[model samples]
Target: MDASSDRELPSTQEDLEIRAVSAERLTFFGDAVVAIALTLLALELPVPEGSTNSEMWHSATSHRDSYLAFMISFVVIAAHWRAHHRVFRHVTATNSRLTSFTMYWLLTLVITPFATDVIGGHGAFQFRFVFYAVVQSAACLLFLLMVREIPRDGLARPGTAPEIFSRSIHRAGMVALGFLISIPVSLVTRWAYVCWIVVPLVDSVIDARKGRTARQSSQD
Candidate 1:
């Protein structure tokens, strides 16, 4: 009989309680999107439409550099996404400024495949290298922005483990610097990807140590 009852419940506290829904969903979608993008690169991998092993090998060899670059890009994106995931894990809410920053990061993430395609053989343009550098730098800046957002939202207070996360972020910033450096380095080395390899390996060491420490700390 009450008009309030007839009006139906407005958006409930449950919805308000989950203020970080957009941030969570963005990270989730980013995980899937980067995954799909990486998988799609495999399709770009040269597969001879022929049956002869010689032809397949030859065709594949012609694409060997491209394939290698694709793999490198995959590693870079995976590392970036890994760092991004943990950064967002402590986030509890999102605002328009942070949302805009994510949009730019996503834009760079989405463009990686196109950059991979361009990175074919040893003949890719320096501009492509520049584009790659700039995109990665942008992602690094966004990563820093996300860290700053934590306190504003009263989410993850600055602490030891969070300091570990901060250290990981600092390493990512180094990778971004490496990416930028590779452009000029490519001016000398045919295998610029050789330098990029350091990113994943470094990320692995950092992540593995973190995982082990986390597991041990939990057990204790």
Candidate 2:
């Protein structure tokens, strides 16, 4: 009984394949949780209240902050799901660490709707902004861990392109850095949103420079 219990990890390629099926089931579970989170986000949206068209238009304008927050959260969650899908596609096995990291990642996703509400609130601008940023940054970093785990633990499929993992890591890191940088900026000004928008453009520039350097090195 002790020897059988000690054998926690799969010992053969067949066992790895079997575990891959279980990992895929976990991915499906994650998809459902993400869908539920999105639903919760939409349900929290405030309806424009009015008796007439003009009044309704005015009410909508008044609730613009909530509308804007919903849109932002929607996009952020969708992007995270997309990245999650990409990472899990190459995954061929899993370990306890990967499972734990995935659950934590999902927890962040589930909290995003509440964070959106906080962002839409009227007072304590800096505190609310920083809180939202922190949630997003944690989500990004946790996802980076998930991405790294696949390769680190030999969880990815054979013949999978290495660039897939590298690209995901870089993007997650850039996004996390953007949110972290915005936290301090939020202390001084509401313009901190500029950080999230600009960081991707900066990442693109860096990638282009690296590609050029690589090509030149090959030529030399």
Candidate 3:
């Protein structure tokens, strides 16, 4: 082999540094955009026109179910966005594929309010239920793509303990599994919304465990 003909790799540290900076910006935008979606969606729902307390109470009370669904969906989207942000913060790559995946997932998220309306208004007809669940599920899958690429840039470097990677993967599995399972359940049960809550709970547990482990490692 002609040594001069062989090309050297770009500086890995330099690539990693640029990628890390871009990933932080992308993740920050993702968080803010999702939050904007929730707020705009909430505003689209109008309050009762009645001026009297009794009449307005009646009007507002009539839409309680819709309000409840909106509240639940909003919280789920917030939790999903928050976890996505955390994962990206630990990432070091922000290449074209990752950017595309984030765009795909965020595009799917933009329909969440419409899905919420369909599911809430029509109840769980198999079609609307499946559609709503599928939208969220697609977002979950795209997020998985974004996260699965995390270990590639030495963030999960040598001497990074196996337990940390294992726990992170396990947490991702919980989210993916919850979305996968909930799709069918949403089609079957009236209370399928409850299943979505499993994701946030899983996130919380993973975050708590991560915090405790880091503290212990630092103490040692």
Candidate 4:
């Protein structure tokens, strides 16, 4: 090849290498963002205002709802990070579209603390519950989109199992469905938070059944 073609080839190859590593860069950035989000969630809990031990205990007891909200949100964010890590583990490359979706997903992740505070401070308000549910559901939806996009964009490494992708999508969808359902349910009753538990509970039963069936099929 000519000198110009040789130079162009190296430049193109360099660009491709950068694109290949983009997913890794994004994953690291995402990990940092999630850590920061969890930290912010903890920071939402206030120090007990009273100076004396008994009085401080009273003040702490008064904010039990805040602590509860913080714990729940922390678990949710940690679950999100785990799911994100699992999906990205198969991803070998990234593009503008994937990056954009990931950024939007992280935006929701970052907003989670604010939503938690809203619900913690105004737990009695139906709208506050709905707002928090909506934020979480949006994050789940965006994550689902990114998971689906992986195979479509050929981002997954060769030989990755189809079942892996399906399960990831299913889990994310179930969580999103739970939150979406909770939104309308919140309007009717203050106990709508219970709806969130349905996702994991149902998912566990379904997973158990699938495991049994797989073992039977293998034996046959």
- The candidate that wins on lDDT is 2
What tens digits encode model 4's per-residue C-alpha lDDT throughout 97-194?
A: 88999999999999999999999884468878988999999999999999999999888888999888889899999999989998888899888888
Angstrom error of the Cα, residue 74, model 2: value is 0.9
TM-score, predicted candidate 1 vs. hidden true structure:
0.73
Task: For candidate 1, give the lDDT.
Answer: 0.70
Give candidate 1 regions above 4 Å deviation. Answer: 1-16, 121-125, 157-161, 198-220
Tens-digit per-residue lDDT, 74-175, candidate 3: 876886777676565565557677788888888877888887787667444767777877787787777767666656545433454545545555665676
Tell me each candidate's TM-score: 0.73, 0.90, 0.73, 0.91
User: Over the full model, what C-alpha lDDT does candidate 4 score relative to the true structure?
Assistant: 0.90
**Model 1 lDDT per residue over 1-220, tens place:** 5877655545455555577576577678778877877777677766555478887788778778788768877877887788877677766567777777777777777777777777664655676666666776677777667666666555553352657456665776677666766778777765665555576567768889999999999999
Between candidates 3 and 4, the one scoring higher on TM-score is 4
By lDDT, rank the candidates, best first: 2, 4, 3, 1
- Candidate 2 local lDDT, 1-220, one digit each (tens): 8787567544665686789898888899899999999999999999999999999999999999999999999999999999999889888778899999999999999999999999998989999999999999999999999999889888888899989999999999999999999999998999998999799779989899999999999999
Query: Mind sharing the TM-score for model 2?
Result: 0.90
How many clashes show up in model 2? 0
From the highest TM-score down, the ranking of the candidates is 4, 2, 1, 3
After superposition, candidate 4 runs with Cα above 4 Å error: 1-13
Those runs of model 3 whose alpha carbons end farther than 4 Å from true positions after fitting are 1-17, 153-168, 198-220
